[model samples]
Each structure stands twice: as C-alpha cells, then as structure tokens.
Target: MKNSSRRRVRPASIASLRRVHSHGGTNNQKQRSLSTGRIGFFALLFVALYWVKLGFGGSLSTSSKAANSLGSSAPRRNRAHLSYDAEEQVAKHKLLPEEAQIIRTARSLSPVTYDKVAMSFFVMYGRFLLPFYERRPDMKVLNIGLGCEEDISARLLRKLLPKANLWEAEERVTCVGSEIEGLHSLTGDQGDVQVLDSWIEKSGGMFDVIIDDGKRHHNCQVLTSFEKLWPQLTPGGLYFFEDLHLGKSDDHRSYSTPACDGSSFVFSDHIKNWLDDIIYQGGYNSKKWELHYVFCQAGGCAVAKEPPGTIYNKPPSPNQFDKKQMLPGEYHFVTTAETFDPVTDKVTTHSFFTMYGRFLLPYYQRKPRMKMLEIGLGCDMNYGPGASVSLWKNLFPSAELWEAEYDGECVEKAVKEGKLDGLNPLVGDQGNNATLDSWIEKSGGQFDVVIDDGGHHNCQIKASFDKLWPQLLPGGLYFIEDISGKSKPEHLIDCVWPILCTHDLHHSGQVEGL
Candidate 1:
C-alpha cells in the first residue's frame, strides 16, 4: 500500500504481456508419435489423453512467462538447433553475466522453456534467490541433508539478507535442518522421514526455502514427503534437490536405471518419478508450483517455484484466536489424557495445536447440536479410555460425538467408565471396507465434521476417506492428522472446504496441517 507506483506497468507493456501470455503454443516434441508396432488405437488414445491433460494443466506456449520454460517450444536458443555455446548464446541473448551464467548451465537441457528474454526456465538459484530474498527474520526454512557443520548456506543467507528484524516475531527467521551424522554434525533434527514430517507438521506452516538433500541413495520418500511440505510452503518458494545425478547413475539407491538420454523419467526412477508426479501434473499442487527456473550444475539441482500470489501466503493474525471458550475439553482432548477433569475446565491448549482448534472450533460451534464423526479412536479399552469421546462430550455438551474405534474391548471399556454420555461409539476395523460401510449405514451417513485421527497409514486413510467423505455434509471439514505422505485434501471428490482461510486481516483461519 505504501508504494502503488512500483506495481504500475505501462499500458503497452501490459497489453504485450497479456498477448504473449494468451498465445497458445504446441511444443516441438521429439516423440510426437509413439512407436506402437501394429495396434495404434490404444496408443492414439494415450496420446489424446496426454494432450488433453496438458491442455488442462497449461502449456509453455500460453502460460504466463512460460516461453522460457524448459518444456516450451520457444524459438530463441532453440530458434532452431538444440545446442548453444557460451559466446553464441551470449550474442544471441545479448546477456549480462548473471544471465550468461544461466545460459551456460542450460544449453543441453530439454523439456524446459527457453526465453532468454523472460528468463523463465533452467534458471540459477543465485539469480532469482537474492532478488526475492529478505534480510528480515521470521522466515521459516527447512534444509534437509546439507550435512555441513558450518552450515555455510544458512550463514551465507544471514549475510545476504538484512538482519535488523530477526529478534521480532515479524522479523526473525527460523531454519531447521535434519540429517544423518557425518563429519559435520548437522544442526537439523535427525533425517528420519516420519520425524521430519512431524517437525514439518508442528511447524504449522510452509517454508520459504526447502532444500532436500536428506538421502544420497533412495530419494523417493523425500520427494513423497515434499508433496505435503510443498503445500505448506508459500507460493513462489524455492525448492532444492541436491545430487540429482545420483538418480541417473547411483546404484546404491537404484535411483534410475533407464538410458540417460534426453527423455522422461522411466518407471522406478526416484528423481524422474518426482518430476513426473508433481510438475506438468494437474492438481492443487501443480496449480501452485509453476516452475520458475531450474539448474543442474555439478550434478545438483535447484529450482524456484512460481509465485502463488499474495493470497496463499497470508500471515497469521497479530491477535491469537480466543481459546477460553474452547478450553479444558480442548486440552484433555488434544493431549490424550485418558480421563477428563471438569474441575480443571479452564485448561489452556498450546498455541501449536490451537491453530487447528481455531479453524475447527468455528466449524462445530455454529450448530451446538451437530453430528461429529471421528475415525481412529485412540486408546484401547484393555489399556485405557479414549480422548475424542470425552473431549467432544464436554466440548459440545448438546451434540452427539460419533466414534469409529476398531476394538470391541475399547468400546466396552468406555461403556463401563461412564464415558459414554452423548457418545455414540462404533466398534469395527477402520481399514476394512465392510466396517466403514457398516458404520456409514448405521449412522445414516450424515456428519457435520469428519476427523481422521485414526490409522495414519496411507491405505487406511484413503479407505476411510473414500467411504466416509460422502457422509459429511456440505461446507463440512475433513481433517487428516499425522499424515506423512500425499494426502490431497483439495483433490478429494466433492469435498468443499468453504472457508479455507478467512479474509479478516487480523484473524486468518489457516488450516494448521493436512
């Protein structure tokens, strides 16, 4: 708001940019036709589907500033030949040193956009990084693996960006890295997949830069986790994947075994699988992560994500959400303390989990007498009592708390402990299709909120979703906690999260974790 002048564009340039963006382009791809021997019908269908998805996803030709993507069919360096010498490229680009540095590394690359004019694809980290880098602190960062004792990158970032605000909540930066023990002790948490995921989930929001060098061998897990982490990151964030060449040749992890010629990722390839799964794909993730630039220098790769716009990166409000109303039950509910205490009704929940409570409280509070379904009831009866049953009982005194617990004894225990007031419990295997269907049938398939705090396993999570999501009412919320891999909440069929985040500048309803 301080300087609207900076955003101003000349009318002619605006029109030109729009024209360039609107132009549809077909990539000059090598494999225009698949080499299907005799039967080409299926192959034709496959080709048609591929193009259709591309059209849905967007193409380099028509994408905003996409003429420079590695996959673009732009006629600049490729104005014809798929090769470029430094001098020739310099002459062709009439470039600066920084621009020349990019050209040098991008010469032999394919499936990338090429528009030296827009500098879209195959870009260097240093070029785009500093331009967008802030000196202030509070920028949360996650650097995996970099296994350096000195933490040279973190130190260098500190020096490049101004540090006058690191101490203030609005100014400080928090960078957490985790890795295996090496000659240099990494300051990060140990590079365990689930542990890192927990840390990311606990961080409660996305990072500005996520550098993953966690594994030298098998990187499939790392990339898989990135799916969850990337959504957490602010739009236009930078992501780095160290040692991309390992995917091409490293046998320790069998990263990739197919021929290394210019082509797409073959099956079972880690790095390529990552690219294939995310980029050029259609989904909320793809819509958010347009490739700004990429560089494969010294066998390592650094990529910049396209700006997601100001909307996705809105910061949490200055005033915290009032938790007094959503209290003691909220505490015992979150902590999993088997017994609920009415005397300590004024218990305070931690800010970390309260973020979830903030957005969730408003959902159920509207209807005091609402139907709440929670899958994966914690604590077995032979051992202990459950949390959600008691929490919901106290939190929503007038509403009914529906639970889907897998064990018979747990339900029996709850019945004995006098914990069954307003609590409707279902005892069945959460992972079983029959059980889920039976539960839906019994409940008449209606719930105001569906919370999956149950089996965090991928298959079980998805199975519960497939069966139970349909039961949730419109404008309802479905939450999956402790999820480490791909769980596309937005991609869920017919599930609409009406208020993902409120526009109330002071009170944003940020969905804490997926």
Candidate 2:
C-alpha cells in the first residue's frame, strides 16, 4: 500500500499497479491491498471533481459562471495589475457635453486611431481639462509629443480651440515624424530638462495646459521634467502625464533603457507623496505654486496647481431669500439705544454688511443648515466682539456660526456681557497656521462660507485665504472685504489679481460671477 522510495505516479495510472499480495500471496494480505486501492481511486476522483468545479482544466460551464461573478458582460481581459476596475469606473463617471465633444474631435483627426471607448485619453482630457479651455478659449496649450504619424492632440486642440496658442515639441522631425501645420513645433528630446526650459524661454510665456505624451517608459525623465516645467505653468494651470500604466509597477523596469531608470523611482508613488505633503504642510499658504488636485486613473494622472486666490461663484437659487428675510434687524449698541435698527428700521448704520447681504442671503435658501466661519470678532469699540457673529445668527438662525479673533480678553468680555450666546468663539491669530488648524479642528473641519474681515493686512488676509480656501466645501463662498484698504498696493496686485482676474478663465461653468 506504501512505497519506500519517493517515486512519482500519475493518479490515473495508480489503479493499474499490481496489488501488494495479488501475485499468489496470502488471502488476508490480498484483501487488505484491494481495500487500499479502492480508497486511493475514490480520493483521486474527488480532487478531479473539485478542480472541474473551480473552472480549471477546460470546464466551460464553470468558467462562464466565474466570469459572470466579476459583473462584466463582455469577455474579461487580463487586467490583474491595473489600479482600477475599468467597467465599474467608466459606468459611474459620465462625460460632460464639452468632454464628449473633445473625444469626438480627437477621433475625427485622420490617420492616427484613438481608443474608441473607455480607453481614450481624450476622455480623460474632457473630464479634467475642458473646464480650463472652456473658460479661456484663447489659453495657451503645449503638447510634448508629436506622433510619427498624425498628431491627434495637436490636431484636436487646433480644431476645438481655434484661438488657443498651441505648441508641440517633437524629438525628431525626420521623414517618419510629421509636424502639424498650425501648432508651433520645437525639436528637442523631452527627456532633457534643458530642452523643456528652453521651450519655456522660446515660447515667451507660461502654459495654461501641458501634456506629456513622450517617452512613456522613462520614469526618471518624467519626474525631472515635471520639476523643471511646473514652475513655468500659470497659476490655475493643469499638467497631464499620459501612459502612467507603463511605469505604475516594478516589472516595468524591463522596459528601461541605459539612459532611463524606470524602476529606480515609481512615478505614481512620487505623485502620491507630493500630494500628501501639499495637503499636510499647508502648501497653499505660500504665494508659490502649490498642488491643488492630483487625479490618477488606469491610464495616466493629471495635476492642477492652486491659484493665488479662489473666486467662488455660488449658483443662483430659484427660491432666493426675499428682501424682508435678508434685512438687518435691531441690535443693542453699547453707545446707542438698547435696541435700535442697524439698516432697515433706521438709516444710522456704518457698514458693508448690507451690501454683502445681497450676495450672502441666497445661501440660506440653498443650504439652510450651512456653516460659516468669520476671521474677525470686531470686539473693540462700542458693540465689540461677537457683534458680527450676532448679525450672522440673526440672518441664518439655523446655521452653525463661528468667529476667530486675536484677543482672548475681548471674547471673554463679550461672553461676560452675554453678547455671544449659543456660540463658542475661537481666540487665535489668522496669520498662524497652528491657529488656523485649531479653528479647523474645533469647527468640525470644514465650512460652507469663509469671510476674511480680520486685520485686513496683506499677509493676514492672504494667509487666512490660503489655509481656509482648500477646506471650504464645494460651491462655498469666500469673501475678502476692504481690499481697497490693503496694507500694500502691490500685495493686492500680486496676490488678489490672479484670484479675481482669472474668474473668467478657469472652471467657468460653475463660476456664476466674480
């Protein structure tokens, strides 16, 4: 029943072997051998059946059932290493009208065939890019790779954005590499940072959109190129790196050449780390270009830089607040009567709150339970500290209101006088990140509206906006009051102009107004 030597035997052939006592052996021994053979045969049969059930060894019915379990109607291709489920990802995201038009335009470009469906790079363009182009039809665009045959991206941008200043950088313009007619073509290897820097110098201005469709397998080149070229991208600009799947895994090292080390650094890992640092370090707090968004998918990744300032355009609600609802009511002034009207009941108020009310009141009907954060407590003269807080509470009683002031004593005094009831004010400096973080933590992390009415100094106003703008909820309102009285004129021009002037040139669909 057992062999002394560890020799292999096929499961099918095991049954054909001679029984231990079958060759004229005793009856008892023969009977035992027969029993063992029968047991071994049944054991082999069970394993074969189990293998068939698992859709192995040509079990068509079982294989079909296994395929159906994956929730795909079409036959599945081997996509084991992909970062996303193709069908599921495609199903959830619908292309916008402008995005769809971008794909159609790319496909219409002759000779070079693009991916027909979910695999199209132009689809990604439509999702992340169309907004910028739609906002600024005359924006500058740079495509890094001009294909040997027809250049789809170059041709497509030329067709869709007729007024856009389009440029293409080709490694070679030999017989194989054909240059397009309308776009500005620069000859240089994109792997060289000098080449990219020179392109910037020759182009004369910063690009609003940059596409890297060159040398997909060169990981180090891509990273180095990004570092050099990023500074040249305009504020609120976008940079797209295509064919990321090529360098997403370690095995891609096989594709590396002597000049490029693909596996020495992973492109996706670097992008992820950069994004994490940008968020954790309050990167937007600086005036320098900072990462706003990093979107990675199965094919490639797109990075968007933060603008110096944010311009939000809250949509006009059909059920807007009436004049009576937004009108400022009576407040107990420390100097005047105990209860006197600020605006509607009497014309004795010195404030811009009435003007701001027109733009702010619509939010009440939009989000009745909206949360608002104001940087200044205004707790000094007359109706000190929590004075503005009282106004907000009166306007949107159902909303969660918060105020941050530099003076803790002013807040304590306001509370002692029963000025701040049903509220907990934050006492900290707006210029400090620690104070901003403390306010963020105490106020449930995010806000629907942020008002900078604090010091009104250049640095104070900028720091508050940079730190808080990222935390503001989508479609949220961010207001910087008294810009005409900034600490320095250059501060307003250098910092405020980019945020306000570019209102008509980026994310314009959701941008209702400046």
Q: Return the TM-score for candidate 1, rounded to 2 decimals.
A: 0.33
For candidate 2, the per-residue lDDT at 160 reads 74
- Candidate 2 C-alpha error for residue 277, in Å: 2.6
lDDT string, candidate 1, 37-102, tens digits = 211111121112122111111132232223212232322333432243446534433222333444
Best by TM-score: 2
Over 4 Å off, model 1? 1-355, 381-383, 485-514
Relative to the true structure, how large is the alpha-carbon lDDT of every model? 0.41, 0.50
Estimate the overall C-alpha local distance difference test score of candidate 2: 0.50
Number of backbone-clashing residue pairs for each candidate, in the order shown: 20, 2
Worst 10 residues of 2 by lDDT: 24-33
